[model samples]
Target: MINVIIVPAFQDNYLWLFHRQGSDAAYAVDPGEAAPIEQALRKHRLQLAGILITHHHADHIGGVNALLQQRDIPVYGPLSSKIPAVSRPLADGDLLTLDGGEISFRVLAVPGHTLEHIAYFNPDEHLLFCGDTLFAAGCGRMFEGNPVQMQNSLQKLADLPADTTVYCAHEYTLANLKFALQVEQNNPALLARQQEAQRLRAANQPTVPSRLSLELATNPFLRVTQRAVIEAASAYNGRPVDSPAEVFAALRRWKDNF
Candidate 1:
């Protein structure tokens, strides 16, 4: 089994460390800072095998150079002109095998939050390391991409197995759920999830790796086709839902201000 450790960094960013049991080889997803990661490696007595870059965001790849100086670990990432030093440029449908274990992952070009954003999926492990694309109860802001692209990206992730464990890069669940509640206050699933998140936060615990099923039930972005979300977006934007794309656009606009 893969043991995952979440190293909190730079306010809300999470650098995920993945390693198999009875092995010293380790892999990190989005090491925004090198100091903490280096310390963690020493503390755990593990060797860095590779680095996975989700995007060119400084908050995601700021520590690549520092980490590389410590060890010549291979770096894999999406094809971005802005990214200077990716050893392996990955594309959609590419498979990455790590360790001697039967571990394999597929690359998904999920753009929207960023034009070159990508997500890594390990079907055998039912794990997804989606940088900023899909968040618990929310989605990323359309910074470099449009609502249509983001919607398509989200749809692709939503089609994953219900039990797929989603590992997002930030701790935005509480804020995202607050917005979701405003949109779907009557949704019992969302309400219960909010309460659970509150409890976890009260105890100083991390609310992450949320299941895909929960997101499908409560996330407003994922429910764009539902009547409640469509009506809410239309009413909020003062526009009629001519199609799902319009609803998505309006929802994205509302969330931008929200």
Candidate 2:
């Protein structure tokens, strides 16, 4: 089994450190800053084997050069010139094997937040490390890609096994759930998830690594096809939406203002 350690950084960003059990070498997903990553590595007594970058955002790749200066390590990231640190630029449907092949991930091209954004999915472990793409209940802002790309990307993730654990890069569950409630106030799963997430946050806990099933059940972004969600989107759009992508576009616009 692969173990994961959460390294919180810069307000809400989470740098995921993962390794196989009994392994001294570990990998970091989206290390925004080097100090927190270095501290976590020392505390866990694990050497940084490699770095995984999901996109070219500053907060995701800011510390890559610094970490590489300490020790040369392979930097795996999207196949784009936006991030020059990527020594192993991966493409869609590519398999990434690391840590002497003990850890392997399928590169999924999930371009919504950025044109080159990708997610690493370990099918055997049922784990997903998606940086600034799919959050606990919310997804990243469509800074580059359009609603169609974002919705399609999220669908690819939603189609994953229900047991998959989502390791998103931010802690935005409560806020996302609040907006979700506005769109689907009568949803039982959304209410339950909001209560649980509130309890976790009140106690100063990180509400992440949520199950794919829970996201599918409660995340408004993933529920564009649902009647309630489409109704809400149409209400906000001032017109009826005919397709799931249209509903998604309207919902994304509403959430952008919410």
Candidate 3:
């Protein structure tokens, strides 16, 4: 059994610490800073065995060198010149073994937020550590890849099982949900989700790792084919949305200013 610990970082970033239930060996995912990760390791009495980088963003790979200074562990990340300390440069379909085969993840190239952004997917575990490609009721802004590429990447993720738990790298659920509700005002699922998210935030709790099932039903970005979402996106764009990618682009741009 693997226990995933959420380490809150600068502003809303979430640095994931994955470890076996009864073992000391652990892997850090997208650790933006060293201090929080170091503190978590000491608090849990865990060993830093490896690190997983999802992208080359400063907020995601900033702590790599500092953590390496503490312990020289293998860094598994995309093959990008921007990200340093990547001893194991990975690509799509690459199988990553960590903790002596105790845990395995399949690399998926999900470019949208960044050109070389990747996700670690464990089919057996039904988990996806997607950096910024897929969020809870939201998707990342297109920084490097175009709308078509981002839509395709999101489609790949949407094809996964509905039970897959998405561990996004940020705590943008509430803000995303606010925009989602605007796109789907009459959707009971979105309204209910808004209520639930409000409760979680009121308690100062994290609302991440949302199941794909819930997101499929409520997330506007994933529901481009749906009539309501298409209508909303079309209205917002002041034009007809002929394709899923176009709808996704309209919605993304709408969210940018929302």
Candidate 4:
């Protein structure tokens, strides 16, 4: 089995460590800080195989050089810009295998958070590592791409298997769920999830690895077509929800100030 560990880094960012249970080989995803990752590797007695980067953001690739200083590991990421020391440039449709037969991941180009943002999917494990593209209850801000691009990117992720586990780069679920509750106040699933998240946070626990089915039911950004979400966005924008694209734009604008 593939064992995944969350190494909290840089305020709220999560550097994912993946390894085959019973093996020393491990891989890290979006390691923003190398010190913590290095420490974790040494503590677990694991060997770094490669690094998977979702984007070129400083918070995501800040520790590439430091990690490389320790080992000559292959770095895989988009070809959009300089990625520190990328040994292999990956694009959409790229397939990567790691963790000694425990994990096999496929890369999908999911832009909008950034024009070059990509997500890694492990079909066998039903896991998705989406970096700032899709959050638990909300989507990423349109810093580089437009609402349409972001909507398309989110839709691409939403198309994955309903049970796929979503591993976001940041711990923004509580805030995102609060915003979602505003738009979907009557959704019991959302309300219950918010309560559960509250409990988790109160206990100082990690409320991550949410299931795709839960997101589909409660995430406002992913529910643009739902009647309640469409109506809420219409009320917020003072316009009719004529199309999915318009609804997406309105929701994004609402979340910007929300």
Candidate 5:
């Protein structure tokens, strides 16, 4: 009975708020600012129970101190010293139960965008709060980790059940889909996804929380082993990119410049 609500923050950031259906206690994920989260809480008539941080990025944890000043709630995050506000430091494979044990999540160490990044997955609910590690059709920039780390991180996510709903941290779907088309032009699934994303954007709606199956079909980053993606990455690098990690690196570089 856990329900998630999207609380739009900065230009493209999306802060997630989740609570049980009949409960007023709620938790926020990647709340970069307190104002919007507070507003959302008031709007939903839910009280802040805790906070969840995936990485140490400012845009993801900027509001943690401010929120703590208002309410002394536990802050759960990766086992990194960078974010000192994390009261409950978690590691890979740690199981966290919240809301009187009605909601539970497994911590997955998905370091790529940042060396300390992690993701939360609720197996029973088929939900993934992946922060900036994996996006709708793209991924975060390699600010700290290398290609191998990112590729492995993405592979871990790809191994999740196909029905998992990806709740990434940004609103980069349309833009990512545009780049996906450049790498896999003949993919009808990508084309259809672009059309659907365009339609959603035209109406000023969010295109996040996409199914993992859709991402597997249309996301170039997740399709690094595909022939079309490999060819495109090789063409971009002016050399044959054989390994999946190499293809992922090339695609990431292309998107960085795109």
Candidate 6:
């Protein structure tokens, strides 16, 4: 089995380390800084096999150069010239096979948080390492892509199996759930999730890798078509929204200030 461990960095970023049981080599995804990652590697005593880049954000690729000094590993990222650290430039439909196919991933171009953003998914494992494109109870801001683009990108992720374990890049669940409650107060599943998330955070635990099923029920960004979300977005924008993408834009703006 592939063991996924959380390596926290830069206040909220979650640098994930994936390795199989009894394995000495592993992969690091979005290592924002080298210090904490180095510490984690030493503590776990695993060798860095490769690096996975999701976007060109500094917080995601800041430590690439530093980490390269320790071990020269193939850095896989989107087919964008912006990220020079990526040795293997990949795009949607590409497959990444590591350890002679012991671990494999299907690349998905999930642009929204950035125009070049991408995600990795293992169908057999039901695991999704979606960078900043998706969050537990929310979605990323439209930095370079439009509302329609982001909505469509989210749809791609939502189309995955209900049991898909989403490993997003940040620990924003509690904060996002607070805003989610404001959007859909009557959502019982969201309320229960909030309580559980609160209990987890109260004990200094990480509230991540949430089930896609739970996110489908609680995430307002993914529920723009729902009656409550539509009503809330309409009210917040002081106008009526005609389409799901329009509602999504309204909710994103509302959350920016919320």
| Residue 223 of model 6, lDDT score | 92
Q: Of the candidates numbered 4 and 6, which has the greater lDDT value?
A: 6
| Model 4 spans > 4 angstroms off | 99-102
Reference-based lDDT, residue 161, model 5: 98
Which pairs of residues clash in candidate 6, taking residues 3 or more apart in a chain or in different chains?
none
Q: Which window of 10 residues has the lowest lDDT sum in candidate 1?
A: 239-248
The regions of model 2 sitting more than 4 angstroms off are none
Candidate 5 shows a clash count of 0
Q: lDDT values of the candidates?
A: 0.89, 0.93, 0.92, 0.88, 0.95, 0.92
The lowest-lDDT stretch of 10 consecutive residues in candidate 4 is 79-88
Q: Write the per-residue lDDT of candidate 3 for residues 1-258, one digit (tens) a residue.
A: 778999999999999999988989999999989999999999999999999999999899898899999687899999998986899999999999888898899999989999999999887788899999999999999999999999999999999999999999999999999999899999999999989989998999999979999999999989999999999999999989959999999999999999
TM-score of 2: 0.99
- The sequence of per-residue lDDT tens digits that candidate 5 reaches over residues 175-233 is 89989999999999999999999999999999998999999999999999999999999
Best by lDDT: 5
Q: After best superposition, candidate 4 residue 166: deviation in angstroms?
A: 0.7
Q: Supply the global lDDT for candidate 5.
A: 0.95
Q: Write down the TM-score of every candidate.
A: 0.97, 0.99, 0.98, 0.97, 0.99, 0.97
lDDT of 4 by residue, 1-258 (tens): 778888999888888988888888888888889999998998889999999999988889998889888587788888865575777788889888775555788999998989999999998879999988988787788889887788889999999999999999888889999999899889999999999999998998888878999999999888999999999999999978747778999999998888
Q: Least accurate stretch of 10 residues (summed lDDT) in model 3?
A: 64-73
Query: For candidate 6, what is the TM-score?
Result: 0.97
Superposed on all Cα atoms, model 2 deviates from the true structure by an RMSD in Å of 0.7
